[model samples]
Target: MFLLSQAQMAKNGKTSPRPRNNVVYQDGCFFIVDFLRFSVPQTTLCSLCPGEEFVRLTITMAATGPAHSTAADSTSASIAPSAVVAKPCHNCRRRRLRCDRSLPSCQKCIKKGEKCLGYGKLLVWNRGVASRGKMMGKSFHVPDQAAASTAASGNQELCLPRKYRFVPSNMPDGEAEAEAEAEASGDEGETSVSINPCLVDPLFQDLDRASRFYISHFTDQMCRDLITYDVPRHNPYRGIVPLIRDHALLLHVIVANSAIHISNVISKGSGLLNGVPGQYPQHDALMAKQKTLQLLNQAMNDIDAVDPEVVLTAILLSINYELVSSGKDDWKVHVEGAQKLIDYFGLSKRSDLSSAMSALRDHVVSDCLIYYILGSTFSARQPNMGSMTSRYPFLDVLPLLERAEANSYMSCPAFLLQIMLSASHLSNLDVITGFEEEQAGYLMERARTFNIDAWAASVQGISSHNDFESRVHVASAHKSAVCLYIHQAVPSANLMDDDNRKRIVEDIIGHLSFILPGNLLLKGTSWPTFIAGAESRDPAQRAWIVARLNDLWEMLPWGYVHTAIEMLKAVWAMEDTAAETTGGWLKKLKGLGNDWIVV
Candidate 1:
């Protein structure tokens, strides 16, 4: 047996004169290749790998028969006895894959669904995960001064980054690759419109085209849709996106949300999931949701060590994913997980978080408060939907509401939320005893006299007449719904008389209808809309509620919207058929067999 490394072949693959020290070949000779590959028979090596290849050991041939093999021996042996240099592409070299030296990109990378970093591109790998100080396993991207000063959290109206100038590559093999990448990364603003498959950050460059689309869609549009009333620059959801992308759990949740939403848009809100308990109607959304759930379940096993913000964000996103599916996508499961996390660890009391995290914290607190209180109001009598948020003294949200009023993305005003929180807290009690009555009465009085116009005017950035009107419409709708919840729910001095309740329900529908479909504030009205729909007694008002909800569905297209609409229809049918049908929203909601967030 003779060992032959292809290194001994000439650059041109022509037969070379035997070196003095080279071993002479013998009968039945076999060749062993030593470039991290197994041995091959001499006949098979020349026949199988027809093209020139680089090997790392000496090659000795059968000199005893016919002196030495030459190019004249066989057509397949043309490259065997000669020396030719072979250069592998960058990806092939790193992965030790055989390369055909394909131009621009390798076939293996294409087949493996990888973005082939072609030859001539320098690569610097992370050295040992950088365990120096707190920077260990952490990286940060600092935004510009304008974004830094705009708000405490989120990627506020970020200035358009400098476009990647398409330099005509002068390198021999990388020119095509440079052009391909530059073309795939369209302008930042066009992500939503164009659905650019390559719109990915350098941090997550390995993601496939579909993942890139979902991530881009979340950053470009979903962030804005989620918040109550913030311009794109000041959107709080943007603040945590960098955090989400790095977290596999969060990224999967975000992508699932975007996927469901995009599906809804594409389907034009058809195929309504009137009621679903098990497998989701949409396949991709369900698979994505299952992945996130699996990751989250693994996370929950060590519940005490998980961050409260992570739990809150996951619950928020999972809720979003459920809302878009129009079925029971297991939102309560996520919330139950969050409740356990809160029960075990408790939210951090320290106020020294980074500005972005602080901003994210406030927004999450506001959203959590809204969802928990709304859930509390609608749920069967219990403080069960959420735990950490309910732990806050109800009255403290008064200051929180006032501060968020001017420039925050809170759907229900802080005062109204404080009232909702207090009302939820009071109503969740075993019974509304005398002491609870005092607190309920105070909240009811405050809600009764809330001047939405004055509150709208107090908002800092409302300069245009249309803007003020939009704010008032949104605030008034939430206020009316909140008031109805308080008067009927909390054992106040004066419970809602049927006449007053009718007026409030009508007020909610009226104010909501005035906001129109194009308004951003309208997106935050789902809870209020549900309350008004569920509370209405008038037939004509119910019909209008149906039509109005259809309009909201057009804009929001959320799973809960259809579910709420169906529930309202059922409630209307129940009211029409039963002789003794008078009941509050919670009494009506009892025995529903599920806990879901209305907001």
Candidate 2:
């Protein structure tokens, strides 16, 4: 918290020879002064300086001797037994000004006939005090009722109150009540104080309580330094491959989430100002946001330097959040960043070795998820900004899927569904344009790397009642439909004759119809908005719209059965009508299964 100005602390207020013993190098304005021990106020100000006053600078070059001491180690008088009963400043309480710790009665408190509150002790960190002038003492313990209520509240405001200012008037009564309950429960002492006490305040409570002592003493900038510069620079995880494998990705996720939270707070300025009844500083939130970004950037560099997996995860996380937040502008950059790792490690080609690396599966899964996210984003309509990137057709996505299939252990249904949807958007006439013998041979070679027979065999092991296998089959069929559509879109493509293309589309529709029954309909459909908003007030309609998903599954040996069912469901629910528009999907779901039990 110290802002040092060595030049100003000197005799001539010039940056010159360092001041020697007995000289008090004090120039900056002092806000809070925490002496090593208790004593009277001892702030020194240079008479010549006016604007320089109030700066929280340290006396870096103050001279010292036996009688005089370095400011860093200036000792305080021992607290007598009677000093335990600290008094509050009457004037500060009456005026609602935060009081500087003074003796039995502070100057303002005495003048105002107010109680002078003495701080028990300052909360220190590591082995030192956090801020200068903070009283060091043991913190008061709260009762069980208070602790349980606070824990049950779920909101961090109960614990981190200082970080927020409660705008009770704007907030609902229940929320304000919870905050009040949390504070009242924590405050065991029934003292008649003028204003609410921050001592028992959950926000400024000791770091030791939370075991966050490491960064407790740190200012916003110092926290930036400790994690961004110090922690990574130390290479704490260097050579610990197992630890990195087990926890590194998770740790990085926490860091990214924390940074996002900080950025949200700063950008929104939601809880930074409120019911405190005075002007509070907003600069800290802004600074904390900047520092968090810097930390994120640093963490990203560290992950990239040490491991490719972490980098891939970070990129995917950024993409995931962007998709959630509708931050489409930065989508491609993140995608390219992920693509770099896939290229670097040659992860596009699945390795055949029996003993693979520890995170091999994870790396494959991450890529699959990334592709799925991007593909979904491409298909989902923008809120108001129109379509995002659609120039790349379903044909172009096949290579990416083929690459993912080669790398992944299982034929993930979600990824396959993405490809299928993309395919459905195109025509079926281009299926055979590029079916050269060599390229066709490549497909067969890669397909051998797949274990379709084993996958099918594994499906029978599950109970007949279970639909996991059916779901996977349906999803894979959907993917096949996508491939068929892509083939038809190419001018020269023709995997199937004109009649066969029609058959493929019909087969896809059949498959869609099979799964539109009972719970399975809602379970499998790829309609984003409806599925995403299923938890809303009306969910029964989703089931009503498609009540024959199981029948569609039985009908479609080819592939279009599923597509047909989807079209039927769309028509049944009125989701396909021009008047319905794209936004009516959720409403349709609500209206679908209003009567019969979807089970």
Candidate 3:
């Protein structure tokens, strides 16, 4: 199978201006370049054959030109012998649109009357629109304050400006990644290389060769992405790799999630949409999820027959699948399932890792609480879902969470997490009974005034100016957001002054600027960004929100952030057309349903 990709080709210390007929190899990837600007041969559409090796690591290059072979045009043949099969072009991939793969440009762009950026070049529109949102684009001028803050943060140089977004990021520094991006002001377009080889791993035996692609993808790529603040060689997921040797159930969970993750990345990064077809072997995400459920059922039927940790991990992975697969209404259902297992297994109370168990549970307590609280921000599947309630109360388990446990997953300080959880619990109580103005005031004061300097002083290993600045910015962002949540949730507290609210919004946006998109901290900012986005009134500010969320989408490559972007646009639309009907984010979020876990 051939792939469509591009790289910044450098020759004699200058970026190449035209395509040349030759083959170039760098890193572990190979590119076939030619002068066939258009008139690509009609390749036979060979649909994925059912359940074969899926993929084998054998790449043979057959050169093609004006006199290559007449037999190449035969339709009955599997694929044109000389044509390299193509993936989506740059424009098609960015817009998540189907490309006809016609040479110099895609027919899809021609039909849409838009410029087709070639397979490899990174380009943009003057005033581009998002693939999913109906919101129209206007010329966006970045706020001076925001631009200055972004420049101060040091990621301004790495920024790849976009007229529109929901674009993916390329961050590979001695780690597992598929794509690499580079740019130089005058004369610095280096010969960038990407080592994206989808070869099977021997560690993943006893599965279809194609299925192993997803398994390997998870272990090598997504697993590291989960740990936002740091990349440790012995990161928790790697600890679980050897466990797959004896447990067939765990492998199914990995495949289900990984395929769905790939699917999410392609489909405009939206869980509400379907995975774009033919990028990889035909592994239906939904079907894989169903198979996972069946395996889970069989394991559940035999009491104490399956390791509880495995069962819990499987349940959590299902929750993950729901997050990327439609923002599925079952988000809370799986969280609830995890709760039941935690109750039965006492995982909430258990902190001892002295004994060997599945590596899945290592950092789960903090992760579970993070998802539980953050999920409450946008869940609209049910009505009056203001209170972040779980059957067992993920909040109460927070005190028991060790700093290492909390730090292992999320990037913010543990103290701030507790404050956010406590504030959410107050919101929950307001929904249950009457609002307690005094209690909410106390929480908001602490949330808004917590000293980041003091907090940093108390913590260990927070070295480097960049890392410290990222933590401080993210901590303050969360502070502003949680305060806004309290103001919305407990209106009786009288913190809803319009000027104060807008100031908080500005602060939240500014903090976001300090935290670069590629920094792990950006992954944690979506909740705050969405909270601020729904409350924002200016179109330009809203445009900035879209750009940052787009950066976020590039980093995480999950539907959760895309879902936030869409939801924010919906809120903006409501305000623009019917100003009186807007009820801030909490009311609008509850209207969306209580099941969305956009983490």
What's the true lDDT of residue 280 in model 3?
A: 37
Tens digits of per-residue lDDT for model 2, 1-599: 23335544464555443433433343442233332332333545433444454322222211220111122221111111122213344456556776643433344555576544433333435332222334233233333566556656663322332233333233457866886777657755542223222234342343222212111212222222111122232322121222223444433332333333333333334443233322111222233334434544665566546455545544554553343223334444555556555555554454542333323334333443334443432233211211213543333334445433322222333344344334433322123334433343333233324444454445435323344555455544444444443342332333445465445444444555454443322333433212221211233544532343433233211122243344345544464345623323322332343211110
Q: What lDDT tens digits, residue by residue, belong to model 3 across residues 1-599?
A: 23222332231232433322343333322333333432343333112212221111122334432322122111212222234326666777877877676544556776688876655546556353442354344223444566557656654122222121111211134321222121212364322222222223345535554355566567766676666544454466655556666776777777778877776566554543232243332255666677888888887788477777777777777777776665646777666666666666677567565434423475654565566666655555322222235432445566545444324435566566666655555554425334367767877887767897666554435332246666777778878887888887666567669899999999999988888756766777777887788789988888999998888777776766677787777777777787474345566556654466556
**lDDT (tens digit, per residue) of candidate 1 on 1-599:** 22344344443363543422222222222232322122332432333234533222332232221211122212222223332224666888988979755433555677788876655547665432354754454433345565455444433332232222212112235755755566558574322112222223464566654465566667876786676654644666876667765678887887789778867765663433222211222455667788998988777777657676876787778877876776443665555555555445443233567876766766665565455555666555444444345444545445544644454444567778777767766655656677777766777778879887777777734322247777888888888887777765653446677788888887888788787777767677777887887778777887877787778778777777788777777667776677874545555554464555566
The candidate, 2 or 3, that scores higher on TM-score is 3
TM-score of each: 0.60, 0.34, 0.60
Q: Which stretches of candidate 3 lie over 4 Å from their true place?
A: 1-202, 267-282, 355-360, 381-396, 399-409, 425-435, 458-466, 579-583
Question: Which is the winner by TM-score between candidate 1 and candidate 2?
Answer: 1
Overall local distance difference test of candidate 2: 0.36
- What candidate 2 gets wrong by more than 4 Å, as runs, is 1-178, 181-252, 255-296, 299-304, 326-329, 345-454, 458-468, 487-599
How large an RMSD does model 2 have? 22.9
All candidates' lDDT scores?
A: 0.60, 0.36, 0.58
